[model samples]
Target chain A: MVAFIGQLGRNVIHAIAKLGDASIFAVSTLRLLFATPWQGKHFVMQLYAVGVGSLIIIIITGAFTGMVLALQGYHMLVKVGTEALLGSAVALSLIRELGPVLAALMFVGRAGSSITAEIGIMRVTEQMDALEMMAVNPQARVMLTRIVACAIALPLLVGIFDVVGLAAGYLVGVEMLGVNSGVYIGETIDKIALTDVYAGLTKSMYFGLLVGIICTYMGQRATPTTEGVAKATTQAVMICSVMVLVLDYIITSFYL
Target chain B: MIKTKGLTKTYGNVAALNDINLHIKGGEVTVILGGSGSGKTTLLRLLAGLESPTSGSIMFSGEDLAKISRKRLYELRLRVGMLFQYSALLNSLTVYENVAFPLREHTDLDKEVIHTMVTMKLEQVGLRGFEEMMPSQLSGGMAKRVAFARALAMDPQVVFFDEPTSGLDPISAGVISSLIHETTVKTRMTSVVVTHDVQAGLDIADHVILLWQGEIIAEGKSNTIKNSDDPRVQQFIEGRPNGPIPFSRSQTAYVDDLTHKPGCVRLE
Candidate 1:
C-alpha cells in the first residue's frame, strides 16, 4: 500500500509537469500562428475537410438519434397522455446535449486520429525537426491551421446537426406518432431557450480547441517508433472523447 | 566559426560528455570521428542549440549560443543547414515542395522565383528532374540528395551532416562523400560531418578530430590522423579490434584473475 501510494504521487507530479509542457508548447504555437500570414487556399482546404467532409456522418448520427429518442419517449410519456411533450424534450436534449457533444466525439475519432497519426509519423521521420531547421514552424503551419479550421467548423457542423436532429424528431412526433405539427413545433421553439443554443455552440468551440491541442500534443510527443504512432492515435481519440463528455457536463451545469 | 568551452553532459551517474573544448574554423570541412555513444551527437545538438548544455558555453560567431533567444536562434539556425541522419523530408510533400519549403517560409518571393530557386538547389544536388517525386519513392541516396536540396534552399553559411555516409552502398557512400566536398566548396559553406566511416571522413575533411571515450583523443589534419603514433588512433583508422582498445574478454579475464577463478559456475 505504501509503495502504491508513492507511485501514485509520482505519477500525479509527472502528469502536472506534462500538462505544463503542453501549455507552453500550445502558447508558443499560438504566438507563431497569429504572426504568420494566412494563405487562403490552405485555409479553405482545411475548412472544407473539417466542415463539409464531416456532414454525412453528423447527419446520419443525428437523424437516427432523434428517431430513436422519439420512439422511446412515446412509450414513456403515453402513461400520462403527455406524448405532446416529446418534441420539446427531444429538441432540448439534442440542442443542449447531444448535437455538439456527439459531433465533437465523432470528430475526435476521424480528424483527431488523423492529426495524431500525421504528427507521429512526422516525428518518426524527423520531418518536424526538418521544419524547424528550415525556419518553418510546424506548429504554426500545420497544427495551428488545423486547430483554427476545426474551431470555426465545429459550431457550424453542430448547428446543422441540431437542426436536422430536431426536424427528424418533429417528423416522427407528427407523422408517425400522430402528434400535432403546429403544437410540436411551437413547444420546441418556445421551451428551448436561445441560451441553450449559445451554450451548445460554446461547448463545440471548446471541444474543437481541446481536440486540436491534444491531438497535436500526442502526435508530436510520440516516440520514434511505429508502435508509438499507433499508441498516440489511440490515446488521442480516447482522451478527446472523455474530455468532450466532461466538458459537456460542465457546460450543461452552467446553462442549467 | 563555432567554439565550445568545457561542455559536459551527465545522465544520472554516467557522463555522456566530459569537459571537452573544441573550435571549428571558417570555410573548412571538420569531421568528428567516434564510435556510437561517444558524445558526437551530443556535441552537435549543443552546437545547434537544440538542447541546453549542463555546464558549458557554446559560442557561434562570438555570440553565446545558450544566451541566444529562440527567435535569434531560429535566425541562426536558418543560417545553418543540417542533414539529419534519416534525411527528414516531409512525407506528405513532394520533393519540390520539401526543397521549396524554406524559401516559402522565410521569403516573400513569388511562385516563379521560388520555382527557380528550388530548381537551382535541386540541380546543385543532381536531383533536378526528381522534383515531382515523393520522399517515399526515392531510394536512400536519392532521399539524401533531396534532403540536401532542401538544406541548400536557404543558402546557409554552414551545413552539418549527421552520419551522411551511413548505411549506403560503397559506390553510394563514395558519391555522397564527393557530393559533400563539392557542395561545401561550391557554396563556400563550412561543413561539419560526424561519421564512423574513417575513410570517407579522411577523403572530405580538411581537418579531423578523433573523439574516443568522450574526449578528443586526436585532432589534426587528415594526413596527421593517418600517421598518428597513438595506438587508439591507429586502431580506429585501420578498423582493427586489437590495439589500445581491449575487447569484452579482457575485462572479464581481469575480473576472473582477481577472483582466482578461471571459469566459475553460474551463481544460480
Candidate 2:
C-alpha cells in the first residue's frame, strides 16, 4: 500500500509538471504569434486544411444527429400530448449542446490527430531542428499558424453544424411526421435566444484553442521515433476529445 | 572563429560531454572524429546553438552564446548553417521550395533574384534541372545534395555538417566529401564536419579532433592523428577489435554468466 501510494504521488506530480510545461509553451507561442514577419501563407494553408477539409464530416454528423433527435423527441412529445414542443427541443439541443460538442469532437479526431502526426514527423525527421538552424521561429511558423486557423475554423464549423442540424430536424419533424411546419418554426424561434448561439460559438472557440495547443504540444514534445509519433497522435486525439466534453459541461453549467 | 571554454553537457547524472576546450579556425574544414556515443554530434549541436551547455561557455566570433538573448542567438544562427545526418529536407516542399525557403523567409529579395539564387545553388550541387521534384521522389544522395543546397542558400559564414557521408555508398560519400571541400574552399567559409569515416576525415580535414568518452583524446592535423600514441585513437582509426576500448559492454564476469544464470542481464 505504501509503495502504491508513493507511485501514485509521483505520477500525479509528473502530470502536474507536464501540464505546467504545456501552459508555458502555449503562453510563449501566443506571445510570439504576432511578432514581425507574419506567416500568412502557412496560416491560410492551415485554415483550408482544418476548416474546408472537415466540412463533409461535420455535415454528415449534423444531419444524422438532427434526424435522430427529432425521431426520438417526436415519440416522447406525442405520448405527453405536447408534440408542438418538438421543434423547441430539437433547436435547443442542436444550438446549445450537440453542435459545438460534436463538431469539436470530430475536429479532434480528424484535424487534431493529423496535426499531431505531422508535427511529430517533423520532429522525428529533424525538420524542426533545421528550422531553428535557419533562424526561423518554429513556434511562430508552425504552432501559431495552426492554432489561429483552428480558432477561426471551429466557430464557423459549429455554425454550419447547427444550421444543417436544424434543417434536418425540420425535414424529419415537420415534413415527414406532420408536426405542423408553422408551429415548429415559430416555436423554435421563440424558444432559442441569441445568447444560446453565442454560448455555443464561445464553447467551440475555446475547444479549438485547447485542441490546437494540446496537439501541437504533444507533437513538439514527442520522442523522435516512429512509435513515439504514433503514441503522441493517439494521445492528442484522446485528450482533445475528453477536454471538449469536459469544457462543454463546464461552459454549459455556467452559461445556461 | 569559434572556441569553447570548459564546455560540459550532462543529461541527468550522466555526462554526454565532459570539461573540454578547443579552437576551430576560420575558413578551413575541421573534422570531429569519434566512435558511436562519443559526443561528436552533441559537440556539433552545441556549437550550432541548437543546445545549451550545462556548464561552461561557447564563444562564436567573441560573442558568448549562453549569455545572449534568444533574439540575438537567432541572429547569430542566421550566420551559421548545418547539414543534418539524414538530409532533413522539408517533406512537404518541392526541391525548388526547399532550397528557396531560407531565402524567402530571411530576405526581401524579389522573386526573380530568389529564383536566380535557388537555381545557382542547385546548380552548384549538380541538381539544376531537378527543381520541381518533390523530396519523396529524390534518391538519398540527391536529397543530401538538395539539403546541402538549402544549407548554402543563406550564404552563411560558417557551415556545420553532421555525418554528411553517413548512410551513403562509398562513391556517394566521396562526392559529398569533395563537395564539402570545394564549397568551403571556394566560399572561404569555416566548416565543421563530424564523422567516423577515417579515410574521409583524413582526406578533407585541415584539422581533426578525436573524441572518446566525452573528452578530446586527440587534436592536431589530420595526418598526425594516424600516428598518435593513444591506444583509443589507434583503436578507433585502425578499427582494431582488441584494444583499451572494449568491444563488448558487459561488466559481469564472463565465466560466472556461463556457469550460473544471473538474476538479470543488462544489454547496452
Candidate 3:
C-alpha cells in the first residue's frame, strides 16, 4: 500500500512537470509572435491547411445539425402552441452553444490531428533537427505559424458554421415545415443579440488557442518513432476535444 | 576547429556517450567509426549542437556550445550544416526549393542569384536537371545528393554527415564516399562523418576516431587506424567474431547455456 501510494505520488509529480513544460513551450511560442522577420509565407500556408482544408466537413456537419434542431424544436414548440419560438430556439442554441463547440470538435478531429501527425513525423525523421541546423527556430518557424493560423482560422470557420446552420434552420422550419417565414426570420433576428455572436466567437478563439498549443506540444514531445507519432496524433485529437468541451462549459457558465 | 573536453550525454541511467576529449581539425575529413551501440551518432549530434551534453563542453572555435545563449546558438548554427542519415528532405518542397531553402531564409540574395547558386550546388553533387522533382519522387541516393546540395547551399564552414551511406548499395556508397572526399577537399570545410562502414571511412577520412561502449577507444590518422594494435580496434576493423570485443551481451556463460539441461543442476 505504501509503495502504491509512493508510485501515485511520483506519477502526479511527473504529470505536473509535463504540464509545466507545455506551459513554458506555449508562452515561448506566444512571445515569438512579435519577433522580427515574421514567417509570412509559412503562416499563409498553414492558413490554407488548417482553415480551407476544414471547410467542407464543417459545412456538412453544421447544415445537418441545424436542420435536425429545427425539426425537433418545431415539434416541441407546437405542443406548447408557441411554434413561432422554433426559430428563436434553433438560432439561440446554435449561435450560443452548438456552433462554436461543434466547430471546434470537428477542427480537433481534422486539422488538430493532422498538425500533430505532421510535426511528429518531422520529429521522427530528423527534419526538426535539420531546421535547427539551418538556424531556423522550429518553435517560431513551425509551431508559432501553425498556432496563429489556427487561431485566425477557427473564428472564421465558426462563423461559416453558424451562417450555414442558420440557413439550414430557415430552410427546414419555413420552406419544409410551413412555419411562417416572416415570423421565423423576425423572431430569430430579434432574439439573437450581438453579444451572443461575440460570446460564440470568443469561445472559438479560446478553443483554437487550446487546440493549437496542445497539438503542437504533444507533437514536439513525441518520441522519435512510428508508434510515437501515431500515439501523439490520437492523444492530440482526444485531449483537444475534451478541452474544447470543458472550456465550452466553463465559458458558457461565465457568460450566463 | 571543434573540440570537446570530458563531454558526456546520459539518458536516465544509461550513458549514450561518456566523458571524452576530442580535437577535430578544420579543413579536413574526420570519421567517427563504430559498430551498433557504440555512440558514434551521439558524438556527431553533440558536435552539431543538436543534443546538449550532460556534464562537459563542446567548443566550436573556443565558444562552448552548451553555454551559449539561444540567439547566439542560432547565429552559430548558421555557420554549420548537417546531412542527416536519411537525408530528411522536406517532403512538401521540390528539389529546387529544398536546395534554395537555406539561402532564402538566411540571405537577401535575389531570386535570379539564388537560382543560379542552387543550380551550381546541385551540379556539384551531380544532381543537375532534377530541380523540379519532389523528395518523394527521388531515389534514396538522389535524395541524399539533394540534401547534400542543400547542406552546402549556405557556404557553411563545417558540415556533419550521419551515416551517409547506410542504406545504399556498394556502388552508390562508393559514389557518396567519393563525393564526401571531393567536397571536403574542394570546399575546404571541416567535415565530421559518423558511419560503421570501414571501407567508406578509409576512403574519405584524414582523421579517424573509433568509439567503443561510449568512449573513444582509439584516435589517429586513417592509415594508422587500419594498422592499429588495440585489440578492440583490430577486432572491429578486421570484422572478427572472436576477439577481446564480446560478440553477445548476455551475462550467462555461453558454454554452460549450450550444454546444460533445462531445469537441471550443473554437475561439478
Candidate 4:
C-alpha cells in the first residue's frame, strides 16, 4: 500500500509538471504574435497545410454525418407525428453541436497528427537545435505561425462543414424522404439563430487553439528518438481528439 | 575565444560532464576526443548553449554563457554555428534554400544579395551545381558539405561539429577532415569538434582534449595526445578492449541483475 501510494504521488507530480510546461510553451509562443516580422510566409504555409490540406476529408465526413443524423431523426420524429421537425432538428445539431465537434475531431486526425510528426521529426533530427544555433526562434517560426493558422482556419472550416452538412440533411430529408422541401429549408432558417453560429464558431476556435498548443507541445518535448517522435505523434492525435469531445460538452453546457 | 571554468552537467543524479576547465584559442581547430558516453557531445552542447551547465561558467567575449538571459543568448548565438552528426539539413528545402535560410531569416539583404551569398557558400563547399537538389537526394558526404555551407552562411565566429565523420567512408572522412582544416585556415573561425575517431581528430586538430568519464583526462597538441603514456588513453586510441575503460558499463554483476537486487532493473 505504501509503495502504491508513492507511485501514485509521483505520477501526480509528473502530470502537474507536464501541464506547467505546456502552459508556459503556449503562452510564450502566443506572445510572439504581437512581435515584428509578422511571419506571413510561415503563417500562409500552415494555413495551406492545416486548412486546405484537410478540405476533402472534412467535406466527406460532414456529408455522411448529416445524412446519418437525418435518417435517425426521421424514424424517431415520425413515430411522434412530428417528422416535419427533422429539418430543424438536423440544422440545430449540425450548426450548434456536431459541426464544430466533428470538424475539430477530423482536424485532429488530419492536420494535428501531421504537425506533431513533422515537428517531432525535426526535433529528433536536431533541425530545431540547428535553428536555435542560427538564432532563429523556433517558437516564433514554428509554433506561433501554426497556432495562429489553426485558430483562423478552424472557424472557416467549421462554416463549410455546417453548410455542407445542412445541405446533405436537406438532400436526404426533403429530396429523398419526401418531406416538404419548403418546410425543410424554412425550418432550418427559422430555427438557427446567429448566436448558435457564434457559439459553434467560438467552440471551434478554442478547439483550434487547444489542438495547436497540445500538438506543438508534445512535438517540442519529444525525446529525440524514432520511437519518441512516433509516441508524440500518437499522443498528439489522441489528446486532441479527446479534448475536443470533452470541451464540446463543456461549451455546449454554457449554451444550454 | 571561449573558456570554461569547472563546468559540470548532471542529468538526475548522474553527471554527464564534470569539473571541466579549458580554453579554446580564437581561430583554431580544437578537437574533443572521447569514446561514446564520455560526454564529449554533452560538452559541445553546453558550449553551444543548447543545454545549461549544472555548475560553472562558459565564458565567451567577457559574458558568462551559463548566466546569460535566454533572449540575450539567442542574440549571441547569431555569431555561432553548429554542424550535427546527421547533417541536420532542413529536409524540406532545396540545397540553395537550406544554405540561404540563416541569411534570409536574420538579414534584410535583398533576394539578389542572398542569392549571391548562397552561391558563394555552396561554391566554397564544392557543391556549386547541386543547388536545386533536396537533402534526400544527396550522399552522406554531400549532405555534410551542404550542412557546412549552411553553418558558414552567417559567417559565424565559432562553429561546433558533432561527429562529422561518423557515417562516412574513409575517403569521405579524410575529405571532411581536410575541409575542416581548410575552412578554419581561410575563415579564421574557432572550431570545436567532438569525435571518437582518433585518426580523424588528429588529422585536423591543432589542439586536442581527451575526455574520459566526463572529465578532461589529457589535453595538448594532437601529437601529445597520440603519444600520451596513460593506459586509458592508449586503450581507447589503440583499440584494445581489455583495459581501464571496460566494455560493459553495467554497475551490477550479471548474477545480481538476474536475481533482482535492490538497484538492478531489468532491461526494457
Instruction: Give every collision pair in model 3.
Output: none
Off by over 4 Å in 3: B253-268
Tens-digit lDDT string for candidate 2 (B173-268): 888999999999999999999999988998999999999999999999977898889888899999997999888899999976865676755554
lDDT of 1 by residue, A64-152 (tens): 87887777887888889998788888988898888899889888887789888988998888777777777666787777887778888
Can you give the lDDT of residue A77 in candidate 2?
92
Worst 10 residues of 2 chain B by lDDT: B259-268
Give the top-scoring candidate (DockQ): 2
lDDT, residue A141, candidate 3:
85
Q: What is the TM-score of chain B alone in each candidate?
A: 0.92, 0.95, 0.94, 0.92
The candidates, ranked best first by TM-score, are 2, 3, 4, 1
1 or 3: which has the higher DockQ?
A: 3
Off by over 4 Å in 1: A31-53, A170-180, B246-268
Which of the CAPRI classes, incorrect, acceptable, medium or high, describes model 3? high
Better of 1 and 2 by lDDT: 2
lDDT tens digits, residue span B216-246, model 3: 9999998899888898999999899889988
Please give the clash total of every predicted structure, in order.
0, 0, 0, 0
Candidate 3: global Cα-lDDT?
0.93
| lDDT of each residue in A143-179, candidate 3, tens digit only | 9999999998999999999999999999999999999
Q: lDDT per residue, candidate 2, A118-181, as tens digits?
A: 9999989899999999988888888888988899899999999999999999999999999999
lDDT of 2: 0.93
Weakest 10 consecutive residues, lDDT, candidate 1 chain B? Answer: B247-256
**What are the interface RMSDs of all the models?**
1.1, 0.6, 0.7, 0.8
lDDT of 4 by residue, B1-268 (tens): 8999999999999999999999999999999999989999999999999999999999987799988887899888889989999999998899999999999888999999999999999988789999999999999999999999999899999999999899998888887888889989999999999999998898899999999999999999988888999999889888888999899878978876686767767665
